[model samples]
Target chain A: MVSGHSSYVMKHHDLPIEVHDLTVSYQKKPVLYGVDLEIEEGSFVGILGPNGAGKSTLIKTIMNMIKPNGGYVKIFGDRPRAGIKRIGYIPQKESVDWDFPVTVFDVVLMGRYGHHGWLSRIGKEDRNKASECLEQVNMLAYADRPIGNLSGGQQQRVFLARALAQESAVYLMDEPFAGVDAVTEKTIISILQEMKKAGKTLMVVHHDLASAKEYFDQLLLLNMRKVAFGSVSEVYTHELLQKTYGGKLAVLSEMATEVAKNPEP
Target chain B: MKNWVIIFGGLLISSSFLEAKQIGSGEDLNWLTQAERFIEMKDPSIRKVALGALLMGLSCGLIGSYVVTRRLSLFGDTLSHAVLPGIAVGFIWAGEKENFSLLIGAGIAGFAGVCCLSLLKKFTKIHEDSSLGIVLSAFYALGICLLTRIQKVGYTDQSGLDSFMFGQVTSLSSGDIISLLITLLLIGLFITINFRQLLVTGFDPQFSKSIGIPNDFLQFLLWMLIAFCVISSLQLVGVILVSAMLVIPAATASLFAKRLKNYLVLSSLLGAGAGISGTFFSFLGKGLPAGPLIVLFSAFLFLVILFLRPEKGIIVCWLKARSERSRIIIENTLKATFKILEQKDFQENEITSLEIMKKRGLSRREVEREIDKLASSGFCTKNLSANDEANLPPQTVMILTPKGWEYACKIVRNHRLWELYLTNEAQYEPDHVHEDAEKIEHVLGEKTVRQIERLLKNPKLDPHGKFIPSITDIHQGNLPRPS
Candidate 1:
């Protein structure tokens, strides 16, 4: 298999994420249609779109949590399943069961599961790493607290600490600023900036368009398909944003629905 | 899978050929004698029954923790019911009640039921609960029909077969006990080896998948283990009540346990405790079914924990609420005293009980009780002699101690500051601010009060033109006259 993939690996080895003509649908409803993207190794990108514009779908598809209907995703020149270890995924806060019987520290320690085999015990180094990550995110004081006892912003911080514990090269965060207090939002953005300065790649799904230009270096404005992808100054225009958030193009969406009705042969 | 089937087939053929012991009926012995016999363990049959119950309890409790945490309690019930038809088919296939054959047949039926449930969810629009209902009732009805047909066929060896509905502990065989032990071992090993994986998957399947946890395989393995638990426990607790064994102990443990590991350990211990106690109770009576007794004991434990556990129990919550109410009443009385002192422009340090009663809208007797409560708690000193010397109608005059004066100043400050802030910052009407401040004053912490103080720029008076006490005045235990 290594011999077979040597050529393809040599070509796309520099890209942190490569998506070629990705299409995704949920229960016969097309969410993303024939979207393509290539993310740089150390740049911070923000994904901005309206609700139901498939921003989350694109991230989930790249993570291999949701399989695309067509095309493929490669992370560091390998399939998502094999290469996902290099990526830290911070899922939406609402996707978890807050009442689950786990403490903040326990959730963060789970980030190290991929580092060792399932049967092996967690080593002292792993524990130290987890503590350091929690300290970095300013959540060490809440390490023993049950996840349910935390406020909304504190809960988001715990998830951020967990992702930081993974120590991955690339990160994909889904709405880290949603429902967070202004102070917590500032704290999380500063941490993301620090991570980027350390040469880690990041892609965040952002809801607020007002802060998008300041927080991210590159912006991917998307609707059903990719509307624009470039530096913030290039893509953060009124016309492009209007195209992305105004609404889906009537003809394109109608055709996408038709194709969904009769899927590929 | 093929190899497993072949090995199981071989075991069934060999086991069926062995001369199996027929289950014996319990005699109507005295209660004392039965209890002593159970403890002595001299009879091999009694020993087998005891071991079977223990093993069944251990396995059910371990698997049921996952079932309850994953919200699969109803699925456990459906799977238990769905295995009944397989037991009947196994009996017919072996031409008798062979334990190995029955287990294998039940396993097959459970696997099929799971497959059907998944297929229905994947390909159709039917909800999971409806699919579970369809599978549960349909298979249970089929099993009932088959069992009745076997009875009508007049098989002489089918006398003890009806005990599968409501378990008879005396009918447990040595082979049944062995099967239960194996199931217990399998469940224990599975949970121990995959504790972290199972936890992550159960808590967040999406994140687990992203990190290469193989969530689907782990879920399938969990279902298989749950099926094993249900099948092996059928001879001890029967089908209808097995799901209770899977849910009640775990639910009881969840009341106090904050971690999954503790929850699992406590649940299994409770399961074993309920099992043994239920067996003892059944032994003390004549012809009592052990299944319902076991289920009843677990349910009773659940109710006990529900009402009596320390952290979140009903009684604890009620006690907490009661204490909070009394504290609020004390604070309000102090605030009322501060208001009376402020009305007099801090000229007097004592207030009569009649003045407090009229200010608080309470009767004279209630006012005396409040003064006595305040004095006992070291907040004030009560002087009835002064009132008597003044020729008053036996009114109690209370003098506020320094502690009392400080507390009263704090409460009044909180109330007035909140009222002022609400009127000025929140734009609330002056009348509306009082009612809200009335409640907020009792619960405001020191930190929040400081924040409010800073936000309002240390205002001197409230919206109602009342003096909002300063911190230095509160510390000094002396109020300056309102300007």
Candidate 2:
């Protein structure tokens, strides 16, 4: 249960993540039809919608993991790569191979590689910081454990630990709680609560409608286009939920596939 | 005399327009004699046929390790075999075996094969495995056919011809040694300058790419090195067995190492060892083939280490599993004993240890070890009212201190709560639920158990009709249930 509201002193005052008239396509069919959103700092924002809502594609475009066809996405009033150091990202856990021969310590150390640029070695200070991040996630006991041996929830925590080691100002987590145990979920929420207290912004791609109200402060209701974007209390109503996720999921999925195939538009 | 005639003849045929730098004179003859003596090791007239073989082995060992670890072993083999047609065509045109023209033709052909493979992979839907297989077999077969055509054209000496196929390690001269040395130096420089980049790219290309490392460029560089190394070592290992030279050493080293640097270094050492040992064996055994001998030695080392290494070996994994099962049984017995003590309140006298063991369905020896472990850990006290050692019935009633009872109850509570959570909340089908919950309950902490209890709204019974423990301790209560 995250329950503290601290005084928000915004130097920029504007929303940390802002997207305006964002349109994306694959080939020539539009996937995102003028989707727009705004998210504030010190907020836990859940990007909520059913499968194939272009929710993942939208985030990837915002992160510059993929180039958008036509859109404007600003993180801290700049491009995603410019603010990469300030933005920590946890990609879907399944995207990586667990059988890869690396220990928990080795994987977490890679977070600092971005900081220590190419041809530069990681220093003692970076190592100490990585250790601290591992401690925060309670994964210090398994620091030397091969990543392959860990359970699904443990692997997710290790990924989260890597992001924490980055010590970024914002976090974008894609499906952090998917296949995670209840305890691991609580651990993640508590860490997010602490980050929130420290005035860091977090955007999570979330499923599990039952816990959406309990977990999120702000919500981006998406279904290939902007359904709603506001505080969860304002945007997470039954009507908006239905619009964002219910009957529109199948139509959005078909549109997403067609759009994915037609990327040029 | 035949070797010299073939070489000079080939040289004249390729660069006939360029003047020969004054036929072998006094100074050159003296240098050649010293080189031949050094190789012979005390033989008066070019003592050792094995020296040429040794130099070839050394070059192949050094460069082959990198190729194997990078998974470019097949590429090495394909490129090696593809050089045959170049050798054949160079000989056919020059009317004699010529090193320079053959090398040029081989380089062009090898590069052509690489280009074809990459283009096919990029432009077509055919997978890389099938594509490489097609290219390797087709080019190699063409080379063999060209070799047959060249052999029939009245060139009977065939000194250079024999070296390209199965390899003529014994025929290596001082000139061949110079080429091998140059290739070694190039490979050493590559491994030194970009060691870290090569390692990271090999281990995880996606991660290297994400961190803004130019992985594609590095991959291209790596493939280029592979091509260079293959061309250099093909004379020594031959087209057919070159892949063995590349793959065996790295495969052997992986069994011995966990880190990338150690694996690379160990691979080199294994390769060098195999090369040296195979050379020695080939010398002693008269006609024993060196390439296959070296590969066999490496394979033998890998198998020995795989089955025998201390911590992570096959034998160790088996032993660890057996011990783990025994430990789990003992831990559970201790847990069951503590449970009985809490329920009975330590008031019943003359309660034999056997009674507890029978109640828990544990063996007597297991129960005894559990009691000993509990006593040693200070979880319980034993031998309080001592009497006659053997004849007097032993006071076997077990009692747990507050600390022990709390720990025991925590475990029991976690187990029951998980069973309920798995059955109801997780929607795990009933028959499959118990074993998963059983394993998970032992590892989960009180904090998680509390969270699960709250999520299930302090559920009274599991889906299987077993009662779940309620959180009683105020300090370790439940989290607020989601609305």
In terms of DockQ, the best-performing candidate is 1
What's the lDDT for residue B239 in model 2? 65
Residues A3-58, model 2: lDDT tens digits: 12212525432557767688888767777888766667788888888777887778
Error of 2 at B15 (Å): 36
**CA displacement after TM-score superposition, residue A225 of candidate 2 (Å):** 4.0
Report the C-alpha lDDT of model 2 over B168-273, residue by residue, as the tens digit.
Answer: 4555455555665666667677767666566555555544544556777877666665565556555555566666766777776656555556666676777667
lDDT per residue for candidate 1 within B1-483, as digits (tens), equals: 744554454334323412122222456678888888889988787677777777787888889999988999989999998898798788888888888888998999988899989999999999999999999887877666666667667666776665565565666877888888889999999999999999998887878888888989999999999999998888878777889999999989888888899989989988988888787777776546677788889998899889999978999999999999888888889989988988897888878887899899998888888888889889999887445555656768889887887888899999999999888989999999988989999989999998998998888888988888888777764566322
Cα-based TM-score, every candidate:
0.83, 0.64
lDDT accuracy of residue B205 in candidate 2: 56
RMSD of each: 8.5, 13.4
Once fitted onto the true fold, the runs of candidate 1 whose alpha carbons sit more than 4 angstroms away are A1-11, A21-36, A48-57, A65-72, A177-183, A207-210, A221-228, A236-265, B1-48, B334-355, B380-433, B447-483
